[model samples]
Target: MNNVKVNVAQVRYREGESVCFDLVEDFSSFDLGTEILSFQAPVHVQLQVNNTSKVLLVHGKIDTKLNATCGLCLETFVYPLSLSFQDEWIFRAQATDDLLETALILDKDEIEINERIFEQIVLALPMKFICSAECQGLCPTCGANRNLAPCHCGENDIDPRLAALAKWQSKD
Candidate 1:
């Protein structure tokens, strides 16, 4: 459904010719191992294919919104994701030692790009999903959400095992 057809004859024969494509694809959900990654909006892709004689360079941009949980606050929020990527595709006949090592060797003129698009999106995801910079997280003493309100627990209360460490800290 999200395939782009590049006229290999046109580009291969003519070195400077280019083609462009715009795709809007519905990818409602994807299985992310233990979690089901759901999207808040449809994925939009824009691609430009350029012929460089040796290879066909594909430049692309993807935009979408996904639901993510805040790492500290544990609240769900919509995360807007935008990513840009560039790839090279060379026909099997034109593939050299270095080109084969780096570029994708294609047997045909058509390319199915949804998998590649998804890969870029997944790699661009943040290691820690924070809703905002001001997230206060939860109180360790009472397990209360600190972002909503301040906790009334005594800050002086310390575990007995950590008391020796606290005492040592106070000395410095």
Candidate 2:
């Protein structure tokens, strides 16, 4: 049950005509993989489709809210994701290896864009998710969240390698 499909069978070729579509799809069924816990709301997609004699061009933006775990604190937080993509789809009689990496082969009159949109969302996800830029991660010694409160771990708990340097500087 894909929510995003654009029918291009009736589109005039090489006329430079364009069709626009806007949809709000329930993304609860789509698995966002391990990076996302759940979707906060329905995904919104805005697309413009154009057909040139041999190629169909689709360009649009996808907006959604994702529940992601913070990398440092391991806390779940809602992250807003917005992605824009432009893809050229070729109307091919047969598949060819020389096709562009980003280009998709059109096999049917209607193009299902749900998979492509999901791919874009996955690619746009950040390598590291953080609740805030100033998030103080858990303390190494006590394993307590530093952002919540300061730990009473000894300030003198310096690395053994650096401890030798500290003694030398104090002697001066």
Identify the leading candidate in terms of lDDT: 1
Model 2 Cα displacement at 164 (Å)?
A: 3.3
User: Could you estimate the TM-score for every candidate?
Assistant: 0.79, 0.81
The parts of candidate 1 lying over 4 Å away from their true place are: 1-12, 154-172
Tens digits of lDDT, candidate 1, 1-172: 4443444555656788887878888775776664566899988888888898878888989999998878788888898999999988888998999988878788876666677778888988888788899999878788888999998887677898799988999999
In model 2, the Cα lDDT at residue 117 comes to 81
lDDT of 2 by residue, 99-166 (tens): 55557877787888788887788788887889889988888788888888888896777898798999
Q: Over 4 Å off in model 2, which ranges?
A: 12-14, 29-36, 94-97, 159-166, 169-172
User: In model 2, what lDDT does residue 26 have?
Assistant: 72
Cα lDDT listed for each candidate? 0.80, 0.77
In candidate 2, the residue pairs with backbone N, CA or C atoms under 3 Å apart (3 or more residues apart, or in different chains) clash, namely: none
Backbone clash total, candidate 1: 0
Root mean square deviation (Cα) for candidate 2: 2.9
Q: What is the lDDT of residue 23 in candidate 1?
A: 83
